[model samples]
Target: MKTIWITGASSGLGAEISKQAQSKGYRIVKLARSFSTSKMENQNIISVHMDLLDENQVMKTVKYLSEQGLAPDVVINNAGIGIFKTAWDINQQEAEQIFRVNVLGMMALTGAVIPIMKEKQSGHIIQIGSQAGKLATAKASVYAASKHAVIGYSNAIRLELKPFGIAVSTVNPGPIATPFLKQADPSGSYENSIKKWLLDPTKVAERVVRLIETPKREVNLPWWMNVAAKAHAVAPHLFESIAGPFLTKK
Candidate 1:
């Protein structure tokens, strides 16, 4: 059976993916800050403590996994943070923390797996990005910036790793009903505004599992959002003027 190592496996999309993938018969290695083996009863599940923002802990965990020699067939970089605020309102420290988890932490974990995958010459690296990465909105400036970095890094690494037979793919999902969103928009205003667009985490988890075998360069869920993103790319100022009001409000 193939082994899949996923970051942020304690909750949200990560937790769903771990449960669903394990049902599919894949050995799952779950990494999260507070994940406990005692809480998990599945024989296929292995819990590893990991804090993405802590470089030292990340390195130690990577070393331990590497020593285990159970080189995973897939590595999912799904740990991330979102801060919804206007660029001016987001303090310097808040912005930095966002980058620390969304960008730097993602890269650090990916870096740890790249060497092992390169040697194996066969593995898929999946990045969970955001629609805001492609289309800028008002209150999510820092979040958007971090996802932009993720998308860029995923695409660039795809080309770099192609020769090694390691596939890199990115999933850019629109609003999802996850704790990340709830924390980012505590007032629930943003979720209420986009309630129609919110997606099911279980559905997304299934997509990620299927994509492990059918590797695509990138996928933007909910075709309408993809269209909107493309349209925004074509005439950004126009789309901004149209969608700016709701997106900007906190």
Candidate 2:
């Protein structure tokens, strides 16, 4: 059975992805800080303690997997933290933490796994990016920047690892109905405004799990938002002028 490693599996989309993937008969290795306290090991699933912020712990976790003959066939970099606020309103620590967790932490874990993947010449790395990375909006400057880095990094490594038979895929979704929204926007204004359009976490998780079988360079959720992101890319100023009010909802 193919082994799948998922970060941030304690809750949200990560947890749902783990559940769906396991149902398909894949062995799951869940990595999360929350797992540091709980023992969730079974024949089909193994939970390991991991805090993306701590590079040392990340290396140790990877080593533990390797020693146990559990080197994953796929690694999903799904752990991320976001604090949504206007550019000026966000403090230095908040900005640093967002980038550290969303970008650097993901990069560190990917870096640790690449050597093993290259040795086997087979693996898949999936990153959970954001639509904000493609189309920037108001009040999410740092968060958007971090996701933009994820996409950029993923794109560069996709070409680098292709000849080695390693696949890189990115799943970029718009706002999802998850605890993420609650943490990112505590005031609930953004959530309330986009209530009708929030992507279902289960559906998003399904797509992510499916990507393991049919790998793609990128997957964008909710076709309409993908269209808008593409349009914005082609004509940034025009799209902004047209959707200024809507974009500022966040």
Candidate 3:
């Protein structure tokens, strides 16, 4: 069975993906601060406490895993945090934390794992980005910027890793109904506004499983959002005029 390591596997999309991957017979090593394996019956499952903000711990975990011959065939960089506030309203500290977790942390873990995968000449790097990565919106200023960085990084590395037979892919999904919403919007208004359109975590997990089985350069979930992103790209002024009110609820 192929081994897979996932970050942010404690909840939401990461948790769902971990469960689904285990069901598919992959040995899974789940990394997250809140992760637990007490309920899992699978002997192949390993849970490690991780805080992406701690670079030393991140490096130590990956190094130990690699040295022990437990390096995974696939490494999923899914750990992230978001703050929903306008550019002006978002504080410097909040923005910095967002970038630290969503951007810098991803790079740290990826950097640590790259050499092992490169030496083996095979592996997959799956990044869970967001639709916000492709298009900018009102209140998502800082969050969008972080994801944008993720997309650009993934694309560049994809090309560099191709010759080594390693695959790099990113998943950009629109609003998913998870703790993410409550975490992003403590007031719950944002959650209420977009609840109906939210994608199910289970479905997203299925898509991830398929990606690991058959690597793809990128995937944009719930197609309509991709269309909207393109529209924004072509006519930013016009698209924003119509989309602004609906997207950024005060």
Kindly indicate the candidate among 1 and 3 with the higher TM-score.
3
Cα lDDT of model 2 by residue, 115-140, tens digit = 99999999999999999888888999
- Against the correct fold, how does model 2 do in TM-score? 0.98
lDDT of 1 at 11: 87
- In model 3, state the lDDT of residue 12: 95
- Candidate 1 residue-wise lDDT, 3-96, digit = tens: 8998888889999988888888988889888864223346677788888889988888878877876567899998888889888888999999
Which predicted model would earn the best lDDT?
2
Q: What is the C-alpha lDDT of each candidate?
A: 0.86, 0.93, 0.90
- Clash totals, every prediction: 0, 0, 0
lDDT: the better of candidates 1 and 3: 3
- Report clash pairs, candidate 2: none
By TM-score, is 1 or 2 better? 2
**Candidate 1: where are CA atoms >4 Å away?**
36-41
Best by TM-score: 2
Ordered from best to worst lDDT, the candidate numbers read: 2, 3, 1
What range of 10 consecutive residues in model 3 has the weakest lDDT sum? 34-43
